[model samples]
Every structure is written in structure tokens, then in C-alpha cells.
Target: MHLISYITSRSQISEKSIQNTIELLNEDCTIPFISRYRKEKTGNLDEIEIGQIVQLKEQFEALEKRKVSVLKILEEQNVLTSDLKQKIDKTDDLTTLEDIYLPYKKKRKTKAETARKNGLEPLAKMIMSQRINDLDYTASKYTSNEVESSEKALEGARFIIAEWINERTDIRNNIRYQLERFATISTKIIKSKKEDEKAQKFKDYFDWSENLSRIPSHRLLAILRAESEDFIRVKIEIDNERALQKMEDRIIRSQNKCAEQIELAVADAYKRLLYPSLSNEALSIAKEKADEAAIGVFTKNLQQLLLGAPLGEKRILAIDPGFRSGCKIVCLNEQGDLLHNETIFPHPPQNRDTDAIKKISSLSDAYKIEAIAIGNGTASRETEQLIKRIHFKNEIEVFVVSEAGASIYSASKIARDEFPDYDVTVRGSVSIGRRLADPLAELVKIDAKSIGVGQYQHDVDQSKLKKSLDATVEHCVNKVGVNINTASASLLSYVSGIGPKLAENIVTYRNENGSFSDRKTIKKVARLGGKAFEQSAGFLRIKNGDNPLDDSAVHPEQYPLVKKIAKDVGKNISDLIGNSSELKQIDLNKYITDTVGLPTLKDIISELEKPGLDPRKKAKAFSFNQNIKSITDLHEGQLLPGIVNNITNFGCFVDVGIKESGLVHVSNLANTFVKDVNEHVALHQQVIVKVLEIDVNRKRIQLSMNYK
Candidate 1:
């Protein structure tokens, strides 16, 4: 099939754009690179549109591969006809192609095959024709040593007819339609596990029923999880009588005895073959859709969390809070190198409040700490209060950073390689400090799934989730632009065309030699070929380097064009950088050429206006309600300040300075009907929520964003 036209018919993109995108993709250009650098060729497609094209192109390739395999199988069976070849060639849908190949698939010993082996094929065909009035006589003629009697022969004929009906593409499609539109999924609590403590979390789904097509993705995933856990038994149901009647109407054409036989065969097919197969197919389709939706939610959340505000280069005092084991403290320099590490017992058992306060004050003063980042875990609120009590010489901004994946990162091989002598607690504290300085730089070290920003993340398809999250990291990293001089290997790995090996090589080269002085120096890294440099040079920045444009998002290939524009505007390239007024006044039309169009020129102008500027906002300190330290402190109607820590399709989970995060259901997200949870709030957004309910025993808190 013509892939460009096929993708165009499926998406809103033009054929030329799709063709160009596919060609670029085939040339090993990344989505971020293609969307950012090849805008003119792709009709100015953004990352989302470019991502859609990539997904569709992969889908087309997968379909074509499957078609080739199917065609080969058919040719090998020696039953391949010209009409069949034409049908296979004309269809692009994988399901339609499978339906065409179903009849020719090799099967094991089954009742139908057994019936054919028993010499009942003629009787089956006669019954299917619906023209024979003497079906009994025909069945008797078919009786032989294998068939004991005419009744037995008729039974075998019915089985063969059932297989025939099941194999009909139109009949299967009709059943599939019924299942897709009318199927109801129901669940029942397993009697033995009804009272199990582990099953209480899924009690809502114990006796639930919902239309399969209408069930929300989260809800379906929950039910499927419950079923997998053995806490409930789930079944897909449709109107049996209606489905049977539809099949009978489609297959039966006459009122003869042959028609009666066809009716029996239809019932058997519906019960034994068609309904079971089509219902499972429908469920699988639903599962795939649900996985896509869940993965989308995760991708968006990860993007927001990764691109969350950065505190910039500042001395930071980070604390990983705990109760009995004491809080692990680490002081980091402006570049996030661990300068000092210690432990302070501020809460319970060994409540060295005075010593803890004294030690923290001295560390802040000694390290010239500009900010403090406390882990939002055990004893977090207490630590914040402790810090508030101490009066430092300098004004230190205190941020309660989310510690979702700090432990995972602390215990990782990457962490061990970075800090060989430091323990996990010290490593975790360093991560918290680094996260405060630049979240994108530190969070890339941990797996996105372990970061804990998604809903039902582990339940979805792992491979697809990893691909999407990896792409998101790549997008965010490229969008903000990486500092080539100081960026860690983890951060550099996500740069376009630079995987882990190349990133390590760059870092190793920097360690042996000095830092990169200009973008040209990057080409000297071992194994970094011309294509790698072409794709990665734009995203990698060199601050205070030999050339000013080296730190900007403008690709090195366009440096000559930028120089011409600068000369035309009667200014040096350095003077032209960040001179928005002068850059905006330059006529872009004069610079358009065969390869460089107006879009590229406009982008160059914009980048020059803000060279090496971070796309993320500056970090700000957030305050939770001082009085609310734990779940018991919460009361109905009490308005408390919280941060949107996690978001799902239903609503967002808000951290209200307590161990338990409160849920704000979609209905409570706003005064109007909330179609999408993201429309009302975003991850890391600070808002005041009113407590709607609190289940102390269950440690569940329900909150509402509609405080008014």
C-alpha cells in the first residue's frame, strides 16, 4: 500500500508532509529533531503531530510486514487464488486481513476436522445449501463405518456446518458489531476472597456492571487488575437471544429441513465459536485503547514533572526526612556536587532538636546555602517546621520537594557510579538537592515508571510506556537545551541522536580533557560521527564559550546564515544575540532560500532573541497549612493549601502536608462538568482545596478544588 496516502487518509496531515516526515524518520532523525529543525519540510508540524506521524508510520510498517507473512503462508498452502490475492492486496486493516486468512489457517484435531474425517463433508454442504428437503435421507446416505447411525451423521454434519458459519467473515463481523456496541462487563466477588483484606481496595468493583464500550479507561483497568488479582471474576455479556437471532436471520434463507439444520448450526456457532472469539477480540481492543489512554496520561504527567520549575544554580541544603532513623542531610554546591553530608535526629526517640537546629544552621552558613529542599516523606512537615524555627543569617528559600523516586534513584547503579563512597541516604539527599536545582537534569537518572507520577502505570503495556516516556524526556531535554559543559551523562543521553554510549563518551572526554569550548569541539568526541553531530549539536549548549551562538538553540549549520543576517543588520553576531528589538525589525523574507524558508528564519530570530534561555519557570516555595500535619488534623470543610502531586483521568491527588494524599474527584474539580481532569489543574500546581471527607481508618481523604 501507498503509505503516505494511507497515513493521510487516517490523519489530518497532508500527503507531502507525511512523505517528508517518513523520509526524515528513515534517515534516523528523531521526532524532536525533525519537528524542531525540519519545520519547513513537515509543513511546520509540532512535536505532537510529528509523533502521530511516527506512530502511524510504524503501524503501517507492522501491517505490511504481517501482510507479507500472511501472503507467504497462503502461497505455501497451495490454496491461494487470484481473487484471494486481490482481497489481501486491497485491504490495509490488520483485522480485515486476518479475517481473510482465517479460513486457510491450519488447525489441530477439532470436532469439525473430526467430522470431515468421518466422511460428513457432503452432508454438511447439502444442509448449508438450504435447498434439500430430504436432509434425513441425505444424512443416512452419509452414514458409514465411522458414523454409527443417521442421527450421528447428522450431528457430525452440524459440527461441520458450525465451523463453516464460524469461518464466514460477514457472520463474524456481525457478532463483533453486537459485542462492540452492546456488551456489558460484569464482575462478582470471589466468595472465598470476599472478606480478604487485600480485596477491600477493589470493593467498588466487586459487584459492578458497566457497558464495555462506555467504561472509562481507568475503571476498566481497575477491574482488569482486580480480576487478575483473583479478588473478582469478570465476564462479558450481551443479549444471547438477540445475538442468536441476528446470526440465524443472516444464515437461514428457506423454511425447509435444511433451514432447521442451519438454525441449529447457527446456535452452536454463536455459543461455541463466534461469540467467544469475537467477545475476546472486543475486550482486547478495549484493553489496547485503555492502555493508550493511560499511557497518554502518564506521558503528559511525566512531561510536566520533568519540566517543572528549576531553582537555577544555587547552594542547596537537602534533607531526606525520616522519623526513627533521623533525616539524612546533604549540602550541594551550585553545580550540584556533594560538598558535605550528615544525619540529624530532630523527631521522636532521639529528639536532638537543639543539636539538629544548631547543625542545620552551621551547615547553611558554611555552605552559603541559598535554598533548602526537604523531602516530602516521613517527618517532612516536622523538618519544615524545624527549619522555620531557625533564623539564619541569610534568607534561605525552603521548598518541600516531592521524594517520589528519590529512593529509587539513590539505590540505582547510576547513583552508585556517581558517588562510590556515599550511602543511599546521602545519595538520596544529593538527588533532592539536584532535583531542586534542575528537576530535568536529576529526574532523568531514574526510570519514569519509578517516578510515580502516572496512574496504573505498572498495569499498562511496559514497552509502550517506556517508549513514550523516553520520547517525552527527549522532548523536554531538547526543548530546554542542555549545557554541554556541565550537564551530566544522564541529561546528555536524552539529547537528540546521543544515546547512553555517546553521552558517556562525551562525559569521559570532558573528564580527560577540559570542558567543551565551542560547538565545534563536540565533533572531537570519540565515535560521534557527522550524522550524530548534525542531530545533537543544536540541543547541546556551551555557556560563555568561544562563540556566543554556540550556546543557542540555532543549529551549527545555520550559523553562516545567522552571521549574514547579523552583518545585514549592521551588528556583530554577539551584539545581535538577545537584541529582540533589532532582531524583530529584520526583514525575514530576504533571507528565504531553497533550503531555508521563512519558518526557519523566524525560529532563528526567536532563538536569537533569547539565546540559551531555559523554557522552564523559576522555582517558587510553597506553603501547606501549618496546623494540618497529619490526617487526624484534617476536618470536613477545612480549606488547606496543597500541591497537585499526581493527576489521573478521574482527578488529581493533592499533597496537603500529610502522609496521605487527598483525591479531588473530577466532579469536585470545578463547578461545571469536568470532561478532562487536566483542564482544571496540572501537576505541581499549588491550590487551596476544601476537605470533603476523610476516612481515617482507610487513610483516604477526599478533597474539592471548588473552595468557593
Candidate 2:
């Protein structure tokens, strides 16, 4: 029951590392902070390893709490023997603990309980003992007003024995193991719902069977979802004969009359009690594993989407495209503040291309727009085409940004607070433009699940999904290093250790006292104490600050060390900032104190080399086939340029400038065998794909990358 011991047994990480991570987490240190700052304490564990330790710690705490409740229950029932208590105390797993407590748990009215109430316990005990000499007489003696005949008494006794056999820890554990190892999960279409159109999407799973242990996460989740919708029936099957034989071998000791009775009880136990429980338990465990895998995929995709190429502080004209309603357009300044807004109809019901082109050209010249961001939604391709045809005064780069969660952000409370006077359309247009300018800053305002970068996202554990996505956002934000003076409260909140309250307070402090010129001013924010400042100072950047290190990833605590290095080298801190030649002259070993190791020193030197450098790539203009505007325009074997919009365990979905995205299955990702989809494709990655098939009836387009 020791927490560290249990965690060490389950994870390959060292016990000391886990212990240190647990202590840091208990002290309210965040995963990013500990992973970045407390490397010496955690043996240089990354954020993922630290996160695993945190999850395991919570799991062990839950197990211990359950154990305490079980002990109290056993004590009140007068069955808490010293040996039993010791066994329960020694067990660490929840399943094993529950198994030990099963026999002592109170139950409602059942055949076994009724027989026990009628005083058939001794006959049940005789059958369990496998003594045949007086088994019939013992059963007959138990026949009372409730039990009329010896056969009836024996039947009741066998029922009691059946319950006893089911409660045996060895029998339950063995059956659970067999189920986990060899169970086959099969699905069938509900006969009544076979003609249901809604069920056709899951048609691939209508007659599917796969080993439960080997089923991939995406397929398993799909089957389970289909079962949940009642369009399909799912079952977990194992060899019943083998399971029964195993049960008999575990319980039957000899071939006597009592043994024969026990054999009958074992059959009832396997068929009625043990099989169902084990099947459900095994499936539940498998489903949890599948959930974890799906969540991992979701977190990775969210991270990639958030960190996608940034166009960086440009004057952008963003458009939310439409056909029936005119395209909603907004011009954003370099800081993403809305400067102008209007609507233009260049398509459909009223084709006002001339006026639209004139207005767009005038606006681009007036606002000095550098890039054009068009939403990849309805009429997007048409909008891009119309914009291209415009004879603008200046050369403007056009980029089609994914509008997956733009509506969600527009209708959010955050959006309302940021733009109380603006409607959803204006806010949505602003979001599209800001996404092209800086994706991480704008995307953090929306819920990660609504971003449409995941598979089975809504079907997984929501709380777990949120936790993982939040951690990923934090990692990305800290890795990129937020600008303290200009970052929104939403972006600030994800920086290493700053929560919502502190972020709000920091923004308020900035509003009252003007922009932060140095890292020390952050401590002056209301309710932001020493610990918060320590964890957050490194990730918050202050451009053109009094201290040059404020804009870099180097922690403020290391400022003194850098100063010493500067003094030792006979140069000012500013002189050594970007002077790589001078930085190379000083030995790093000399700066490595007991508190700071070579790793921290090396990172400090690297940061000093390129202070405040952005890690994200620059956004570039991508074009779909000019001739292809919708699914109707697609043809088999036609090579087209597309962006990878979503990735899953099975494959990646590519946007080919159509209403329906084309699927490039994992097998089609490369000419050779592709094992991992992420290895070959990423979110927002531009690539050329060939149309393999287009199903107009289902609106599904299959694409391949193997075409020349």
C-alpha cells in the first residue's frame, strides 16, 4: 500500500524521481515549471513523465481511500481478522482490493442469501469440504418448512455453494486473466435498425469481430459508440468450455458425491456469475486503455494546431466566407484590434463582384493590409478566387485559415468581454485574422475539444481530455514564451504557473500602471506572490525592457549569474547578449553552481545567443487546385494540393478545397509501409494528394500520396 512502491512497480521511472515529483506536485508546482526549472530535483524528467507521476499519485490516493472504507466495513461486519486485514493492507491494486472484500460485502435478497437464512450453511460447508459420506443426510436435516424435500434442500445448498465459488479470489482472478488475454469482441447490426440510415456510417462495424486485446483504439471506440447508439449489438466472447474446465479444476478436489455437487455449483458460478462479471471488468479496463490512447492523439493534434505556422503581427484582412449571406470581412491592425468591418457579396444570389472587388481594393490600400485570411468554410474557394481576381493597389498575400472553432470563440464569454459592441460575425472575422497572425494566442480562447483536430474526442472521458489539453496548451505557451505586455489574459493564464485569477490581476495591474518594462514589475501584480512570480517570470517576455534578459527564456534568478559571467569577461551584459564569439570564450563549467547544473547553463547560453527567437514557422500561402472548388470538381487520379487538417490513429484528413475533406488512410501516406501517421503527416502540413475515389452518394473522398 506504499504509494512510491506501487508507482515504481507500475512505471519504469525510478522511485526517487517519482518521490521528488510527488513532493513538487504537493507543493503546488506545475508540470511545466517543475519540468523546466526543477530538473535537478526530478532527475531531468520531461513534462510528460512528470504528468504521469501526478496521475499515478492521484490513482494511488483513490485506492488508499477505498481500502480505508473497506476496512471499516469489514470491521463493523465482525469479519476483520488479523490475517485478512494484513492481506487487504498489502494489496495495492483496486481490482485486487475489491476482490478481497467481495465475500464480506453485504448483499440484497438472493437465492444464496435465502438459503443461508433457512440454515442450509452446514450442508454448503459439507459440499465445499468435499466429504461425501454424510452429504445427503446433512442436506436432509436442513429441510424445514421452507424446504420440503432433500433434493430442494440440496438445490438450495448448491446455490449457496455457487455464490461461494464465485467469491473465490483465485477463481475470479483466473477468469479475469483469461478474459483479458483471449476475449473476442464482436458486433452485429440490430435487425430492426438494419435499414436505419443513421446506422450506415457505422456499416463497417456491423459484422466486425476482433480480439479485444489487439483492437486498435480508434476502431474500439467506434464500435463502442455504435453499440451505445443501439444500432449494433456488441458482445465479448471467450471459450466457455475452457472457462468451465478451469473453474472445475480450481474447485473440484476429488470425485465424490460432495465433489459432484460442487461441480454443479461451479457450472452455475461460471455461467451465471463469474463470466459476466469478468467480461464486463475486462472490457472496462480495455476501454480505459482505449480512452488514454485517444486522449493522447487528441492532445498531440491540439498541440500541433495551436503551434501551427504564425504570420506574426501583420495587418490582415480576414473573411468569414458564405454564399447565401455575404462574406463577413474585417481589417485587423498589427495587434489584432478590429479597425474596420463590412460585408461583401461576391457569390450566389447577388453576384456583386465589381463592387466587392472595388471595396476590397480600397480597404487594402487604406489599411495597408499585408496578408488576406479567408475562412475555409462554405464558399471559401469562391471567395479566394474572387479575391485573386481583384486588381488591388498593393501586393497582398492570401492565406486560407481553418475556421474549425471560430464560431465557438465568437460566441464565447471571452469574445463578448473582448468585444462587447461587436456581433458574432465581426468577432469571428477578427478570430480568423488573429489566428493567421498568431495561432497560439487566438486558439487558446476557444475550448480545445471544439477545434476539430481529434477523433472520438467527445466520446472519451471529458475531464481527462480537458486536463490533457490544458497541459498541452500550457506546454506550448511556455515553450513559445508569451509577451507579458501584449498577451491576452487567456494566453497569459496558460504560461507556466499563472492561473486565471493571477492572469486577470496581472492584466489589471498593467492597465493601471502601464506596460511592464521589466520582469520585476510582475511581482507588483495583485495576489501574485513570490512562488507565482518564480514559476511565471521566465515564460513572460518584455520587449525593449530595462533588462535585456527579460525578453529571453533565461530565468530572472539566473540574471545575477549572467551578470557575473559578463563581469568576468570584461564586458557589459548588453555587449554579451548576442556576441556568440564572446560567449564561447567563457567555460560553462565555471558557471555551474551546486544549484544550477550544466543543463541550465547550456540553456542560458543558447537563449543568450538568439534572445527572444520564435520557434514557430512563418505562415505561407497555400493554394488548392484552381479548377476544383467542391466535391463535384474532384476526379479520380487528379493530383491536388491540400493541407492536412486533422490526423488520427488510422489516417489523416486533407482539405482539398471542398465541402467534404478527403481521407488519406495510413496505407496511402507513403510509398513504403507507414506505421505511424504522425510521422508522415501533421496538422496544417501542405502536401499533394491524388484522388483515389470519390463517392458522391456518401460524400466521401479517398486520397492517396503515392501518385507521381
C-alpha TM-score for every candidate: 0.99, 0.98
The segments of candidate 1 whose C-alpha lies over 4 angstroms from its true place after superposition are none
Error of 1 at 104 (Å): 0.9
The best candidate by lDDT is: 1
In candidate 2, stretches whose alpha carbon ends up further than 4 angstroms from where it belongs are: none
Cα lDDT for residue 307, candidate 2: 88
Model 2 RMSD vs true structure: 1.3
* lDDT of candidate model 1 versus the reference: 0.92
Task: Report residue 77 deviation for candidate 2 (angstroms).
Answer: 2.1
Q: Report the CA-based lDDT of candidate 2 relative to the real structure.
A: 0.91
lDDT of each: 0.92, 0.91
Sliding window of 10 residues with minimal summed lDDT for model 1:
129-138
Q: Which lDDT tens digits does candidate 2 get at residues 602-632?
A: 8888999899899989999998888987789
Q: Give lDDT tens digits, candidate 1, residues 1-708.
A: 778877988999988899899999999999889988998899999999999998888888888999899999999999889999999988989999998998888988889999999999888998888888777887889888899899999889999999989989988888888888999999999999998999999989989999999999999999999999999998999999988888888888899988887888888888898888888899999998899999999998999999999999999999999989999999999999999999999899999999999999999999899999999988999999999999999999999999989999989999999999989999999999999999999999999998989889988999999999999999999999999889889999999999999999999999999999999999999999999999999999999999999989999999999999988989999999988899889999999888899889998998999888888998999988889888999899998889999999989999999999999999899999998888889899999999999999878999998768
